[model samples]
Target: MIPTNRQITPETPLDSLTLDELDQLLSEKLVTLQVDLLKTYEQQLREHEETLDHLHRHRRAISLPPRPTIGQDDWHSYVYDTRPSREIASVTDLVTINFTNVHTVVDIFPVALDNIHAIYKLDSGNGYILQDDTMHLLTVRNQWTKSPTGCSCPGQASDTRCACCALGSVLCQVSASGVSNTCVEDSQINSHTCSSQSPRSLELDNAIAFEYHTYSEGVQQVVVIAKGENIHFYRLDKWGLQDFHSLKGHNTINLDSPVTHLGYGEMFVEQFGTVTRKRYLFTFGLDSSSKRYYEIVTNPQDFSIETGLSMMWDTTGTSMKVWQNGGRVIIGVQDGTNLNIHELTSDRWGRQQISLQQVLSLPAGVTSWRSYATGFENFLIATTLPLPALYLTVATIDRFLQTQRNIPRNKLQLVGVTAMFIASKYEEMYCPEIGDFAYITDKAYSKAEIRKMEVTMLNELGFNVSYPLPFHFLRRNSKAGSVDASQHTLAKYLMELCLPEYSMCHYKSSIIAASALCLSLKLLDGNNWSDTLTYYSRYTEEQLLPVMCKMASVVVKSSSAKQQAVRQKYKASKLMKISEIPQLKSKLINTLAEKSASYA
Candidate 1:
């Protein structure tokens, strides 16, 4: 409803007031009430202005790259000189290991080179590797519980996770040496073993490629044979021994497509049809560079792989893929030139296709780095990781928002919260609710205080929530036909790859901004050369391109000096040279474009 600029008298009743009259009264009351709101917002604006001013004032002195990466010393000191066996310790081994399927925990393993004996997928969303050295399952949870067999032989026993609490099942390990799939049940101390119908098959060279399966709420058990290119399902349930399904084999020597192996959990396996019999089967393929998703309609009577929908990604020069979020499916359709998102709804045959027009609705820009993680409240969150420098900038802005007046607390919280969400994308599967943030805040902030801050922040920032800056560069730089012929090449490259929505700048300026931002962050905080390059390497460098990486470092340092000079010489004019900022943004875009065009 539109508000009126009229005054109201005290005689107006609460319900008797007309819509117009109510609006007028509400407007008047708002003016009166907002005296505090205005002041708060104004204070916040001033703080934001001051921070910008301070940053400008000290811009020359500010360092480009942060020094001393986190955990540098600890990382270097923890040397792995000996090769540890990757075999899972037997049930008789006296040790316990924490197990989980969480992705964040994947990077926390102290021993990377050590062989993983068994990979355990828990009902809880986390994956863990069985280790022989410590004999303890390590997880991101930071704690481990001893299995019944290993309870007495624990090396570190701060806390033990009760076996009963576990889902009470382990992935059947099949090796050439032939090991039994028996493990102690959570409720029962005795071991329950599943026999191997075929004496251990070492058909596959890579153990990591092997997958585990079990169905029937444990009534029917099925072990998936992931050896070779084709998948073969073996029924391990009381159905005795029988080959439930065997995929048409493909000889690796006659490779046809870039075959990628994707993982599925219990829920996905359940969706494969029903507990009683097999339900659905499908495979995904890519056309040179574009991603195509295909689903096969399976008939339990006679298993068949049906040819489902085939889709061609709209944009050129992109690395595209699909990911499932909780119940919903998310398709990552990178144009290689621009970023696009499409929601897929399947037909009766499971044929799914997305329209080009609908692709326009997503958050614009070529994504630099994106990941889905499970949030605290089981909500799924897609996040973008920030460079260290950008994080510092955000920190500075947050500080300003907190202390400034005229800004609502919610406003400031919005910025920090959104950034937090973006950063979490590369790590977690989900993002927590806004209320979750509020709940956590109680440990440090009061509700009223937060509300006040939010209001002030919204007012100060002019309520701008769009941060398509990264995408802008991606689109321009990543376009399929883009060429690196001008200063704007980098920007074009960014637009091509990132597909960032346009804001107020040219494609070139956008490229400069994104590249500078990323470069600055890496300089300030990245540990190794590879970590520093990250997305930038897609366009600017090759696999482990040390020389290109070094060039990026030089580019950032040179640009920092140039920007500093501009700040000093022009002082008032913020004009700066384009060369100072690294051109990774452009390079990435052009690279994707070339890649796309090649396929086209």
Candidate 2:
């Protein structure tokens, strides 16, 4: 045992003490210090063990639920419906409706197969749901009532809520009642003076864009609007544009420059081996020296601005899109018609990092490619106008060239023309006369020979000319998402630009549309998508990212002589001079190439 109190000193006089005595004193003191340190270490170990055990018990008591299995099925089911069934053969002659009196159309909602086919049009401050035989005019009103019964109000009853009136005389009567029953009687009196407020009227003149998305409940639809610097979401029912929430606070976006584009989409990330989902709103606009991008989390349950990832690009952005499971972002900027593709990946520490992958020039004149193909295909499918005929026509020609090794390269164009002619005769309401086809070909083949080739083509195709085309899917998606007309046009142009590239033929129509729309939105500085868009397009941002980047690369290389037809046509003002946009600098292209190589 060590002494509790001891002094290891020359207290008895050092010179008088022997060597053995001094050594004994030093040994005793050293042993005492070692024992003290060991006791302290043991006490610390016990405390730490207790702390660890407490933490374990607490964690066990409040254990988290099992994480959900996230797979392709989950992704598909969570995504919007890309294809909705509709009759193709029941239609009569198409008719166009024009709203002559309306100044600007804010929104249009078509309710299909109602007792009577109807369309709802919201213009200025008024809302009109017009049917074949009836028209309902919607108005906004706010009023206070004295009874629980219904009042003479045009708005829906569910939209109104009860409120207490603070007018005189009620307070004295309530106090006269006993305090015990005062609470109950006060509630009764308060219920009687209920006031209902209606949704405020929308200012159509100020509305820049409007889109509809299904609420979390899934049944109710909410209309989101981008007006000035603010975004507003409204609940839509029989009454139009009911105020839900303004989407402000910490996530509020106040731009120094005017907002040019707005987009919304959901992002999924893996956190601690579990999938976490977040819905984000993306905005792009010009700042003092360059363009800036902002991303805000808009899941009403937890809203925040992702300022850490938001950044300003070196140039002014006209459009931007996110895809590839949020691994890639593509932006179309105005600095010499440049398209910048960025790869978002995790760094060594698993933190998100974005690097510029590719910068490419926007090729001119994709419109001509589309126009020629469209005209030829439309003539073939004139009768049924089935979109599949167009795909089949392309497929037949592709298969022929692939299998027939002996076929001459010079005959490819002729084979394509023949396929289109054969497809039209089978699908069109009235196949263009063979003479008309010959005329279109500048009388390249004699009438009899052209007729003979059509027969040969049908025999080779086994008389089946039905396949899906991307145009219909692209158009449907653009309409459903309310893509701006200009952006839609640009998307269509991008789709046409892909036609001459043999590699693009492997992709389906939906995939093509998804990529084209992604690129188009970037070019026009528009929102890439909303949750509703994801559902409708049946595509997630991440899934479309790689395709978008590929398309951007193709657009860059397509500006040469091989694609002159497309590039020349878009140079016209009528096509919005899409093809003549500025090209990206060579230095930027090289830098992007190096980055892309590194990313790969």
Q: For model 2, what is the alpha-carbon lDDT of residue 7?
A: 41
**lDDT per model, in order?**
0.33, 0.46
Badly placed stretches (over 4 Å) of model 1 are 1-244, 247-255, 261-290, 298-328, 333-339, 347-351, 356-600
Tell me the lDDT of candidate 2.
0.46
What TM-score, to 2 decimals, does candidate 2 have? 0.33
TM-score, candidate number 1: 0.27
Candidate 2 per-residue lDDT over residues 1-600, each given as its tens digit: 324454445456766556776687767677676656645754665565456556745975795654333211111111001111111112224455665544433334322222323223343434455544445553322211122122222233452222222222122122222111111123434533322232244532112222223344433433334444554444445434344323333423455555544443443444333334443444554443224444343333322123335555454343443332221233222232333445443332324444675543333200000000111011001121133445556767776666566766766557766776776666555454554444334334545667676777667757666655777788788888888776776776777777767867777778888878876775566365568778998998777766666566666776664545556546645567776654322343234334433323
Which regions of candidate 2 fall more than 4 Å away from where they truly are? 1-395, 403-405, 426-430, 439-444, 582-600
Instruction: Tell me how far the alpha carbon of residue 331 in candidate 2 is from the true structure, in angstroms, after superposition.
Output: 44
TM-score of each: 0.27, 0.33
> Candidate 1 lDDT (Cα, whole model)?
0.33
Q: Listing every candidate in turn, what is its Cα RMSD in Å to the true structure after a full C-alpha superposition?
A: 25.7, 24.6
Give the clash total for candidate 2: 25
